[model samples]
Target: METGERRTATERTWMFPPVTGWTFDQVKDLEVPFDWELVDGVVVVRGETALWHNHVRGALVSVLRAAETGPYAAVSGQCVMVDEHNVVKPDLIVCDPRGLDVFEVECAPVEKVALAVEVVSPTSRQADRVRKPALFSANKVPYYWRVELDRDQKLAVHEYWLNADTLTYFPAPSHPVHQHKLITELPFPVEIDLDSLVGF
Candidate 1:
């Protein structure tokens, strides 16, 4: 099994920190400023999410906090398992607090989450909207949210939920805070105020 000191390197590929048989404790003790989410035995690091991305996160966190009361927790920006080679660092994650245990060094065994949110940066829009939706659904996460951002701190909220055949997202009806567009499926009803979310 690979250890922190034995990380292998290859050109032009994202670093795949070796943790083949390392314990969660070993993953956490690594000397790095970035937060990591481990799936199977691979490490995924999160780059800086843009400022507008954060603003939208704060908005949803407020709504989620007000409407629910339970042991479940809502967090913005954390990595969770998507599959053996695909570890995803969602913009926001809401899951059982008890499951934080799964986030140890080399693995997190969570399969479901109360909610998952991703705010789009130009650099990550493709990954956020297309890549993650498939991964989240394949893993059966219950709820997924996408917040799209454009110049001037403008934004859009796209909500997704499980559908019988595939995961889908429902875009807002009015002109988007940033005029972004999407398609989605949300089992529970949601009233998204696009303007307010982007400080219009």
Candidate 2:
């Protein structure tokens, strides 16, 4: 019979042995330092975010939360289960309040999400620009927003609405409140001040 200490050592050694082909549930069970997303049974690990990244996320969340009305609330860094095989954590999400229970810890179902937003980062550019948008659209998420900060720190927001018939996103024109503000009406009426957000 194996001793307790011996068994503990063996378990620890094999605990995180290669996560390839893992399901969202499996990845969720692990003790990982960084957020993990399972895309097509492959694990995508997120790196540590920078100060600017966090600042932008905070400003965006504040804007959304302030404008939120009736049943929808802005949440940050929450895992969204796109399907059994795919799970992703968007930078910011606006979701139905009923779908989330503060007492329980779990990923929000994709159906409960009203809007998904990804703020571009150096490490996440490709996935944010391509994979995530496609996944959100396929799951019939009503709205998607992308925030891009250029080299000169100029901010731009791209909004898209899901076309139910085609199950794809069609770009929606952003309503500029002025030289520094961008406004949108979907999900809710919200205006973001790019100059203040980026310290321009």
Candidate 3:
């Protein structure tokens, strides 16, 4: 008997093969029960985001699309290829309008992304704050914003801008935390009422 061996399914109802690492293009085809991402050649599954998290994403999408002064547009949960071995699905992405039609794009190239946003929740603290920023910054996504539930349990926005040379994120210089209203010219000039996310 060998330590590592295979098992026969026989007449089992369902069997999932042992798989490791998935390319960005192949991820969309996986019919799994939960939302997922591919990291380090493995499919990592996490429960779906909270309802409030999605509501905030939806609101930002509308705001960014309406405020677009360029050819970029906002979409929620679009898969992005971070590298040959990694694919990330951001909570929201503002990206170039090209190659965005259905049947045309399975996952967006990292170069096409303008901004990536993550709305922080308890379950996603590490992924949103640490892992995602590191990945996005290394890939040179122009901007990243983290929407958070602050100490008062009210929504706030933390903005980060990427430095191409260092491959890292620096907090936007002026405001440490953006709440109530967020007005910015970078990443296509979108204005949003942060508090409005909860009204949905």
Winning model by lDDT: 2
The residue-by-residue lDDT of candidate 2 on 41-104, one tens digit each, is 6666787787888998898898899999988989999989887668889999999868467568
Provide the overall lDDT of each model, using Cα atoms, as 2-decimal numbers.
0.58, 0.78, 0.77
lDDT of 1 at 132: 75
Runs in model 2 deviating more than 4 A are 1-20, 174-179
The clash count for each model shown is 7, 0, 1
TM-score rank order: 3, 2, 1
> How much lDDT does candidate 2 score?
0.78
Taking all chains together, the TM-score of candidate 2 against the true structure is 0.84
Q: TM-scores for all candidates?
A: 0.63, 0.84, 0.85
Assess candidate 1 and give its TM-score to the true structure: 0.63
Error of 2 at 170 (Å): 1.1
Candidate 3 per-residue lDDT over residues 80-132, each given as its tens digit: 87774588888889888775575777778899999999988788899999999
* True-structure Cα RMSD, model 3: 4.6
- The all-Cα superposition gives candidate 1 an RMSD in Å to the true structure of 6.0
Of 1 and 3, the candidate ranking higher by lDDT: 3
Model 1, 126-160: lDDT tens digits are 77878777777777777677776655655556566
Clashing pairs in 3: 21-41
